[model samples]
Target chain A: MAPSDERHRARMARKQEVVAAKVARASRDKGLLLVLTGIGKGKSSSAFGMIARALGHGMKVGVVQFIKGAFSTGEEAFFRRFPEEVDYRVMGEGFTWVTQDRQRDRQAAEAAWETARAMLQNPELGLVVLDELNIVLKHGYLPLERVLADLSRRTAGQHVVVTGRGARPELIELADTVSEVANVKHAFAQGIRAQKGIEF
Target chain B: MAPSDERHRARMARKQEVVAAKVARASRDKGLLLVLTGIGKGKSSSAFGMIARALGHGMKVGVVQFIKGAFSTGEEAFFRRFPEEVDYRVMGEGFTWVTQDRQRDRQAAEAAWETARAMLQNPELGLVVLDELNIVLKHGYLPLERVLADLSRRTAGQHVVVTGRGARPELIELADTVSEVANVKHAFAQGIRAQKGIEF
Candidate 1:
């Protein structure tokens, strides 16, 4: 096609996209499951977005923080404002090394899993954010089969997200979608420190 | 508490977390919007496990998923990956019924404020997952304030995840972590039936 023709096609395509967006917006479907794996960061950050997003819409939200425990971060503080808006929980007992207790970690995992299981069973729950659970299974902290079964049996409309490094092939296989983060580079390696709000 | 009591408590805590799987993973601190927004099914699933937990390990993660994107479906996907993870964007699209105009859904506010801008400005974007962005800001179709500015100013250390109903956000987001999927939800939802692997 001539350049003018190509330009016209592009313009038309743009218009069509605009219309499509409108249609999609008007035709929203049920929520989804997102699995974040690989060697990159931002998995939890993305999940938090969903948690906040769900609450913003006046939808009930529940968060299970597997590794961070119940410590208050900027996000937890923000989420706290809407105590009624979101049913959130910090599952982990701080950092693994800080705790320096294997048994404690296992207990934390089990406790968190219990909450996760309960939330999963609730039919009305719209979105469930399971942060850093891959490691829980990878380390055998939680029964993989049980987690898989629960996830498979979750409410039809509920959306679930699972994040962590070394995501098991079984989990990936079972997951509706899988993402592997391949690390290209990092700033900490260059002797840079983390900043607040941005890195907290 | 007394130091001796604290010591005893710490020891007990350590014993509890024992046997909990612990793996050392590396993450990056880039300052760009690493979006995973598309018309795919697993944006949040992928974001939660990897990004959030990474943040928990002293890494920073930011997330933003458009539409009534919040809610806890009872999955440990994102927050489990915290510390290394923080920052979030929930589109608050709330279901399609509220966001009647795909082209001008409520995220128009998000798009206008440029929540992505603040996230992009951070130099420690170990991961920036723009969960569900494609549907939210396709062609700047919605309010085009912040999303545009952030997309334009994003640096390299940040990662973004965007997931949800559509794919236009992908055009400008320029995802380093891009994966688009056509979901196959439960067959029963489609009326025929609900299978385990293909549908779940």
Candidate 2:
């Protein structure tokens, strides 16, 4: 290509760069209700990231782990150390597969929902993460419509994140930002197994 | 509470739900980049959701995997079945910790960057996921400024995602959406081990 042609391309590229940056900046101020859905790992992990970020910004943060019950995560371990800043709950049930009781899962989900609903209503709550929540919704353990209704009604400026696999299309439609964590290549797939502090 | 107070509370609660739903809907058409950062599993998985959704909408998609060179993810396995619709690359060198060689890592990053840059330049690309890219920037193995500049210059309709822990502040500052996965309660800590097709 001619030098002049190359220069023209460079100039156009630079112009495009400026335009893209401006557009991204405009989109940042927009609040999003993200849905991290997919048949993969990391939905809760991604949700927890937002929880920590919200807390870091001095934003009120609340977390309700539907299937996890009251256990310690690397995040809760750190955040719960200063309990005043975080409202954390773990539903004490492992998962549907482990527990293998829909009725019991439903009870735990309902119990967790009470807390989640409270968090959603709190105007001071900047971020609310419903970790592993889709399982509850998917298993029909929780009423999807009510959960969506409550989530839709969260206080202004409050951001809610719902994470789990098999997220319903209706919920995805309702979400401001819907993300699916599709299983791609994973180390564990190679028989490496999950390493603590890495896959947790 | 007085009867009037109870009625007013119900009314206000209902209003909040509507408003939250409105905000979420309005956010969809607006293209945005969300980063999933942390030591926990599932960042790439979350990104794949966006890729699949984008494709479902008949939107063009591109992916650049930083640590995973030439290997295929489960999603990739599924997605590659429709190769004509998706552009994907897996950096074969794996993670920085695994490669353990700065020069090789840089070369791998550069190779991944080359593909990513091309994808960024493609106006037709609707969603671009740079998986496990945080490590590259965190370790200074890749130039942040160039990545940022490229991202800024990418197509306005394009939504870019970056995944990995220890992302640079500049990258986070530039992100339209930022999520950090914190380790709260993980089953791995209990020696339950990561089950196949689930954890992977």
Candidate 3:
């Protein structure tokens, strides 16, 4: 082996020892609550990715769309193909900025939350995704405390993913994993329209 | 209608007008270079989500794994099922931290880049995902300028997604969309092992 390779090997051997120690210590097994939030895109997309992951493991998944019912999305179209494994629902009338009616939006959010609560209670589900739930909570369409209460009461070993911009502090605190997607640059900001498959 | 409903209608009507005008003005149609980076999870997951999106549209996709050859991933297993649609290759020997041999790692990255370059040249591919390319770039296994040059030469309507932490500044500047996934809380930080299907 080259001298550089020998040096690298020695360095990695030490690093592996440390990583192995940490890995050995990490033995917990339980359901995780993951939050994907912030102004950048890919929040709901990542949640759908987890749904895919869960499904790949031959586990059932439930998906509830809280605020993107105005149009059909690529994820919904694709995941819905697995009707037996995926309980998918587009429960929102539309985004608040689009629907505009506060009462209507609140009612829709409540209905969506009811469906989400049902999924959380279902022990058969391995993963439950509440897509854009943060936006509903942000708009105060559903009480944050009530949402938190329901989330906290989810069945054991049932992972849940809540995604959207402006995630509440309580949700963030309760989540096992929280990822904030920061926007460095966006096509829309550069006068590019949202494409069919990409944006949806 | 209620008085509040009337006010909401007026507000949304105005908002719609503004949104429609903006949408109409933003008419550019071209392939996008998206970079997902930072010290958080879901970068590659989000890219896989896009692969799902592209597949939903009956579009062809290519996926190249640069630094995750140590084990099989849920994404590889899932996407590879549709062999007709996805051209998947796990080109890396493993992560640099794991493989340790800098020379070997550099050879693997170069080989991966050659495969990636071929895919980028193919106009029929609607989306191409370079999984963990940023990590390869970060370790100096591949020249950033060469990668950038090849990326610039991609077909007009072929979208590309490059994911991993420590994305180079030059690549970030060239990307049409850039998202930095910020780590707020992680399960591993709390001594929880990476679960199969979720972390693979």
Candidate 4:
């Protein structure tokens, strides 16, 4: 039957009622712990997008990059345009594969974690983005327990977003929202270079 | 074993060589057809992030929103700040559940697609974001064949991003890159409201 049919209209009416009830019941307000993971793109990009959203809503934001930063990215240049609203830091020496020294990678991650911990404790920062921190935790550069403790100790209304592949199960368990970005297809696999303004 | 060990050093050397060769092979550059879908948050958020990136790289962007115009979103507000750099449109009556009118939705989606088609043909637009287009396609609000035809007819150097849940198989096949954002846990499930700046 067409959507204009009585049966379809009736079904939709019933569905709407149920949905409205559910929406009405969701009344609580609290800080969100979000994990963006899986071996695909958009993990960090989404977090940065949230930073833009928070800023639009008059929220101060902080960012600490843990395992990127070999080269400057488009986000760094753009967000830097709003220095007063965005506290952006690119602390990673580079990826572990590029650094090739566990000790150096550990030092970079530890320093990045110090900044992240401080941001987590800050109530004034409406949102804190720990970009690529998952890779640091996966490589054991920082203690997962310590990271989790710091996340838990955050101010009640300060949102936190952690992004990268290979998210820890413990972190996922504690997160209020978890999104796994699955790589269905990739341009790189098709011999297309990761171009500027798209991949970054 | 420590990364400074001979074996680890040798392994890193071999891996780096292979990665460098792969990077060298990816010499071709072309327009990208990206699909961001699946039932989770950040699909539109990531697309907005790419919009930011394109703007940062001095690229003019066009955005056509198909099914999300009931309320004002943070992305729309932020991007509006850069009106000269962005062409943003919101052409939806609302979600199907909210509007409860099929004829109106079809008219709105068709109108939105007309704008999207023009953007695809315009080579000057470096990036075009079809926000929530997948949902429109899924709902059969617009003709699938016409949509695909317009996509394939896009300018050689223009990038296009389509975001929403339940991507069509034909669209996915045409997409150079496809990401499925899986919802593992959502705060709404725990009675937490989808707050402003984060969920919008």
Candidate 5:
């Protein structure tokens, strides 16, 4: 082998030792509360990807949409095909700006939370995705304390993914994994309308 | 209706007019180049979700994984099930740290790019995903200029999603949409091992 190959091998061997040690040290196994939030897109999309991952492992999943029931999404259409594996519910009336009724929106959020609470309590569900829950929380439709309390009651091995823009500080504090999708540039800003199969 | 309801209706009417004008003015329809990057999770996962969306529309997709060919991913398993609609290729030997051979890694990246180039030229494919391509570019395994030139040659109306950390500045500039997944918190930091359904 060349001298460069030898040097590369040595460097990798040292890195592997570190990585292996870290992997070995990480032994805890429990359910995680994951938060996907920010101004950028792909929050709910990421949560839906987790749904697919859970389904791949033959684990049941539950999805509750908090503020996107105005129109159908490709994810909802696809996941709904597997009724046995996915307990999907689109409980929101629409976007707050579109609905424009705070009282009605709050009622819708409460109804969605009720379903989410039941899913959180269920041990059989490997993952529960609260799609756009942050928007409702941001609008003050639901009390943060109540939401966090319900989340805390989840089974030990049941994961939850909350997604949307403007996630509360309290939710972030309780989450094991939190990813904020930052928008660098959007197509809409470029005068491109939302397209089917791409955005819905 | 209650007085609050009347006020809500008036507010909605005004908002609708503004939204409608914005929607009406946005009419551009063309293929988009989307980049998902940052030192955070869900970059590849979001791309997979888009694959699902494309499949839902009965559109063909092509996927070339540049640096994650060693382990089996849930996305690979799920997307492979639809061989008729997806042309999926895992071209890399493994992660750079694991492979530890610059020459071999470069060869793999070049081979993957060859496949990706063909897919990009195919107008029938509505979407193409270059998973972990950012890593290959970051390492200079493949010439950035060559990759960009090939991308520019893609057929019109064929969307592409390039995902991984450390996306190049040039790629971001060329992209129609770009999202940076910010790492607010990670389960690995808490000594939590990557679980089958959650991480993989």
Candidate 6:
């Protein structure tokens, strides 16, 4: 082999050792608390993907949509197809700005939380997705401390994914993994109405 | 009614009119090019979510996976269940860093691109997810100009979602919607192994 090729192989071998060591270090197995948040799209979509992944493994999942339920969504329709595997619920009336009724919104949020809390408690549910729960918390419709406490109370090996914009810092602190989907550009801004399958 | 309640209603009514005007202005109906990129998780997962959404709407979709085919994935397993709606293809042998074979990787990318091109030409496929195509472009495995040209050739009502880290600037410029999944924290970094449903 050429000198450059030989050098490259050696470098890769060294790097492989490092990665292997890191992989070995991560020996523990525990269900994770994941938070997908930011002022961009895909947070809830990613959670829905995880729902599919969980269902792929024959794992039971529960979905609680806390806000933005004014219209039906593609995910809701898709996941609901598997009633046995996916326990899907659309609990929000709409965004707080749209609802314009703090009492009604709070009641909706509390009802959604009750459902999420029940799912969290059930060890049989391998994954629980709280879609847009962060928005409910952000609007002060639900108590953050209580929500965090319930998340902590989930049984071992029960993964939870919380999604929405403006995730609380406390929730971030308690999460095992956190991702922020940052908006670079949006189609709606360009005079394109939200499509059925793609957006809703 | 209370004075505060009356004032709030008036404010909401005024803001609703403003939003209504903007909604009225958005009259265009065209297929969009969506790009999901950044050094974070969920780019491919979001693409899979879109696949599910499209399938729910009875829309045909094609998926071309690049740079990550060393092991089987949950998405491949799940989406394969719907053979009628999803044309799933895993073309990449592995990442370039792991494969360490540029010629082989280039061939794999070329093959994947060929599959993608076929999907793009068929307007019957409502959404074509070019999973990890960005990585191929970033690594110069495929020509960006050729890829962009093919994307532009897709029928007026056909949508495409390109997902991977390190998206080309030109691709972003061409895309109607763009999002960057920013990594805040990863569980693997804390010595936790990647779990099946959540990571795979």
User: Model 5's DockQ?
Assistant: 0.61
User: Which stretches of model 2 miss by more than 4 angstroms?
Assistant: A1-30, A69-72, B1-200
**Clashing residue pairs in candidate 3, if any?**
none
Best by lDDT: 4
In angstroms, the error of model 1 at B90 is: 15
State how far residue A113 of model 2 sits from its true place (Å). Answer: 0.5
Estimate every model's Cα lDDT from 0 to 1.
0.57, 0.65, 0.86, 0.87, 0.86, 0.85
Kindly report which residue pairs in candidate 4 clash with one another.
none
Q: Which stretches of model 3 miss by more than 4 angstroms?
A: A1-3, B1-14
Tens digit of per-residue lDDT, candidate 6, span B133-153: 988898798998999999998
Better of 1 and 5 by lDDT: 5
Model 4 chain B: worst 10 consecutive residues (lDDT sum): B2-11
Q: Give DockQ for candidates 1 onward, in order.
A: 0.09, 0.04, 0.62, 0.69, 0.61, 0.60
Q: Which run of 10 residues does model 1 chain B get worst, by summed lDDT?
A: B191-200
Question: What lDDT tens digits, residue by residue, belong to model 3 across residues B130-160?
Answer: 9999999988899989999999999888889
Off by over 4 Å in 1: A1-31, A69-71, B1-200
**Ranking of candidates on TM-score, top first:** 4, 3, 6, 5, 1, 2
For model 1, how big is the iRMS in angstroms? 10.7
lDDT of 4 by residue, B161-187 (tens): 999999999999999999999999999
DockQ: the better of candidates 5 and 6:
5
How big is the positional error of residue A95 in model 4, measured in Å on the Cα after superposition? Answer: 1.3
Deviation (Å) of A4 in candidate 5: 4.6
Question: Could you tell me which 10 consecutive residues in candidate 1 chain A have the lowest summed lDDT?
Answer: A190-199
